[model samples]
Target: MVRGKIQMKFIENESSRLVTFSKRKNGLLKKARELSVLCDAEVALIIFSQKGRLFQFSSSNMENTIEKYLEHGKEEETTTNNTEVQQHVQPLKHEGAFTAKKIEFFESSKRKLLGQDLGTCSVEELHDIHIQLENSLKTIRARKAELYKEDIKKSKAKEKFLFQENTRLRKQCGRKPNQTPEKQKEIASCSQRTVSLEVVTDLFIGLPPFQ
Candidate 1:
């Protein structure tokens, strides 16, 4: 008859739990021995009881076998850790090199902007720089033209003020307003003739005392 599957769990009763532990420990050791002899393999097993008792089995010296297992595990762990480090370091090295090259390119470009280190530039690079310079010069000239226009406006204002002052002074001196250029020349000549007549009158008065 096919038997029902038993639900596996800890035996609750202390007596039954102890009984089960003894039986399972012996069975496990017996199986280890059988497997070692049948397969011609080294075997080791260890068990701890609920009461803190130790039970163990080994095909060879138990201490040496345990030590060998531990050493082998440590060697495998070390190798795995080294492999992981190499995998991570390889990508980091590539990234560092890429970053360094980018920084170098930026520094070289900066040098070029400052008009330094131009000896090794190719013809195309020089042409590009010339175009940039030409655009900058155009901007500068446009700014200069604007400044020149402002200065011309200021000069016109100053000339207007001077002309107004000259006209006021001429009016104060009893000169006619809006006289033509020819009329101005005639006035100057009449003023000169009056001065000559005064000088001759002074000379005749002084000559009578001399006679």
Candidate 2:
């Protein structure tokens, strides 16, 4: 008699669930034991009840069987990782070779640009090289103009900062907010005299003492 396929679903009733769990757990352990004995193989099984009870079976010492299983799993994982690394490395190796070739080509082109290796170029090639050089020169000129503009901007900012600092220092020194031309000339003369005095002091510092 052919038995119809069972429609599997979760047992919602607590009592029915417990009964099914007990029956299935026992049958699974029995089959594991039978397989271990008949085939002379290491077998292990583990189960957990809904109430958090532990059930387990092993053909030999459970600890040893579990340790061996864990070791086997680690070995398989290591092999898989090594394979993946090799697969990834192969493409990188190919790309490295391609990059090296590209760099060599650019170096050769640079030599041609400097007129160091033009013995093999035809007329058309020479004309193309001339156009490339002209374009490169234009680009360089544009870059230089941009740099000059940036430098001018920085110089203007520095000048403004220095002017503000001078004004602040003058105020701190009790200088009049408005200075006459005669007062400015007097200030400049005083500054020159102070600098000369500092130089004279420095020159005499290393002089020998008179006996």
Candidate 3:
């Protein structure tokens, strides 16, 4: 048979309230035990009567379960606190941090390279900076020379292609072709020089010192 929902109110009579509390407390404990056993879950429940009577249940050792619960709660609290701190601190950039110090060091080094701050540098440090500048200059010059050679090679190839086209056009127009063997030999020699330049490495190419 279907029964209407029970009214939600405190039991006013002292005897009825005690009986109700005993029945409901036992029912709740039974439910907790069933849940733990049926779902293979850990469950704990604690009850206090109006007279300060204590009732408790646990799927395992009650002390151990309570300790585990407290530990888990503390960990969650720590995680939440850490998240809040990060959220607030990130917007503030936590000025004067390690990363900020590193950036400042890099900027100081850059200024030194630009010759803006030399008062703090010693003679040995100055010599090291000078060596660094020399190495950088050599690399820059090497790259520039490589690009210049490439441009020259491309220009020569384009010139040769255009000359061949001009010769073909001249023959079609019944004009004497001006591509003589000497001109062809000069073009071939120029191409060979470009190829030789491309082969030249940045290594020292001088005779050994005399003993």
Candidate 4:
């Protein structure tokens, strides 16, 4: 292991700095590859040369390594935030179960606000998340609506082509095919029920009482 505390001042000699950077870059890459192969770890390195060009390396996929780094950082941040919360709430530890749980809930929210460990969130925290989801969905839906007009026009053109074909087929057969009223009603009812249930569940999950 190359371990030392190096001075922070800039190396004024351009040749020396360039040589040092080249040597250290090779050493860093060697260490990264060895760690990845030996421990089954992923590594990503991003360096900018003195000339401002980018140099990058990855043991696996660069995107995967970067995402893993972000996720690991979030987990570390969540743990650190939770520790801070614990210290703040330590005086409430002697309180009853209900109060202790409320403290836990707030602490968990703090973690979520910090974007850490959102996977372990409770039902109440999930409700809070659902609210954020709804706001995001609203923005998405607005953009989708703008795109949907063009989609509708394309669908209508396809429908017209299909209708012309159907007309030609009906003229040849001298008969029209129809869906039975009972089957149509059943399909309509099922679709309505599915939509209603989805809406109800979304509302139920994000209710303020749970929060």
Best by TM-score: 2
TM-scores for every predicted model = 0.55, 0.57, 0.47, 0.38
Candidate 1, 1-211: lDDT as tens digits: 9999857997789998888889889999999999999998899999999878999999999999999999999999999999999999999999999999999998998888679899999999989888888998999999999999999999978866776787788899999665654576799999999988875434353446644
Give the per-residue lDDT digits (tens) of candidate 2, residues 1-211. 9999856998888998888888989999999999999999999999988778999998899999889989999999999999999999999999999999999999989999999789999999899999999999999999999999999999978866776777778899998554544577799999999988875343456778889
Per-residue lDDT tens digits of candidate 4, residues 99-208?
87899988976777667887877889778877887897899999999899889989878866776777678778987744444566799999999988875343445546
Question: Please, what are the lDDT tens digits per residue for candidate 3 over residues 64-151?
Answer: 9999999999999999999999999887786648779999999988887889899999999889888988999999999999999999
Q: Clash pairs of candidate 4?
A: none
lDDT of the candidates, in the order given: 0.89, 0.90, 0.90, 0.82
Model 1 / residue 63 / CA error / Å: 0.8
Stretches off by above 4 angstroms in model 2 are 1-4, 120-124, 134-211
Ranking by lDDT: 3, 2, 1, 4
RMSD of 2: 16.2
**Between candidates 1 and 4, which one is better according to TM-score?**
1
Please give the TM-score that candidate 4 achieves against the real structure.
Answer: 0.38
List the lowest-lDDT window of 10 residues for candidate 2: 198-207
